[model samples]
Target: MVPVLREAPELSLWLLRSPSPDSAAAARLAVRELDDAEVRRAALFVRPADRVQYLSAHIALRRILAATTGCPPESLRLGREPGPLLSPRTSRPVLRHPPVPVHFSLSHSHGLILIGTAASAVGVDVQRTPTIEAVRVVGPALHPAEWRELLALPEPWRPAAFAQLWTRKEAYLKGLGTGLVRRPAMDYLGLGTDADAPPGPPGWIVRDVLVGPHHAAAAALAVAVEPRITLRTLPVACLYDGDAGLPLSAAPLLALRRRGSWTLRWSLLERDPPG
Candidate 1:
């Protein structure tokens, strides 16, 4: 399971609903609350089925982000990999906040695409339980030893761990903004693990995050804070309504002990790497 990390000053977390809610009113209600600019911006990528879902998720994100830093909606911008596109209206707020070089990564499964974010270089990823066949098809990211680690895990946790590693690597990719264009093995290994891999792509802090219980996830950021990976679970309702903007305020969020697909996270954890 990707452990959820909350309370990192260097990093923050947000969830984009795979679907807005049971009713269209919930989706539309969330959309109407978004900044007009954010809605128009997301429209550029809207697909036939993506129209409603896209609006609900992105708009929710903009509201939450604006609330977090107390910045006006007009000044904030969402990046392609969930990057921060804050325009600042002018150069002063741009200089003051300097946009913080936020990075984001996303993945979906079982109708949910979990997202995580951080400053500068950051990566986030999500996956539902891939088929047994899919596990065999992961390519070179999993070395012989890593596969051994996966195999060593008990039956219940194996698939979850597989999802974790895959998402962690993918999150690192998103952090690099290279997507799948670059090979993760060539860049990182056991990302959130104690293996002592390189920091991150040029000028980024290398961190990992696990969001859900059955799910695995990793995030890459720019700053090097001793791994204070805090994890929390927010409900689809609260996330879409922009309530997750407050730090460590997910007390009202659901406390999911187990789920088929859960998010996980690994920050620059406080413990020393195993040597």
Candidate 2:
């Protein structure tokens, strides 16, 4: 049976730390769960770390969908045209047909990985806090009104406020699938008067996510109603343990046995900073 979410208008965010033996094991399990094309794409990654990150993110997404759809994890097909979607393979216009009710986005920064899933179209972004000088260099490119407003902020708060604004813009664009191709300058995301509650584009709801003191993250959903997000750290063992009837090979099982218990630290960004 498909498990229903405990909260309405809620999004699920899963975080995974840097690659380790346990993560590697989890990646292998993820590989087993993926379709052949996905496995081929994963194998093409030149860097082992990149491969692990891709696998871990996709694995967590599959687990989430499996729980929601009551489908076997391995049987749930996922594809990336630009954003996450429930499809057999990667292709543009995955949404040209009936829109997939489930939408998701993924972002990774430094060693932290974030995956967000919702019933509506969603996008997420994470960025490391930029140096004050870095912010100054790029600040002018923002919407003129936004830049002017940012300058009025107290000096100490500028960096965080800028980070918040930047991520929100990025998340919104990502949701739109235009990325930087659509001039951000043309859009006004309010960062000047209110850092926590920026004026997002109409029809989209934006929220700043607090990953930690050093990093900033944000999410945008294509719904008027603000989404309540639930964040959790997914351990490698949990992925293997909750295979949802997916077959596992002996090699991955051996790897899991060799690795000791793995733990991840997570911080919830329940609220934005007081404006």
Winning candidate number (lDDT): 2
Model 2 / residue 4 / CA error / Å: 22
lDDT of 1 by residue, 130-240 (tens): 666566577335654466566666656666667767776666656655566555466544433435444444554544454444445565555544433333443445433
Clashes of 2: 0
**Worst-scoring 10-residue span by lDDT in model 1:** 87-96
Per-model lDDT = 0.49, 0.64
- Model 1 has a clash total of 38
Range of the 10 consecutive residues with the lowest summed lDDT in candidate 2: 250-259
Q: Estimate each model's TM-score.
A: 0.60, 0.70
Encode model 2's per-residue lDDT on 1-275: one tens digit a residue: 99865443767666665455344364445467767876787789887777766776666667766666667668776644653333333222222222346777788776567777787877788887888998899999988778877888887888988888898888887776667666778788774464544455889877776566777888887876545666555555445544452332211110010012212222223322111
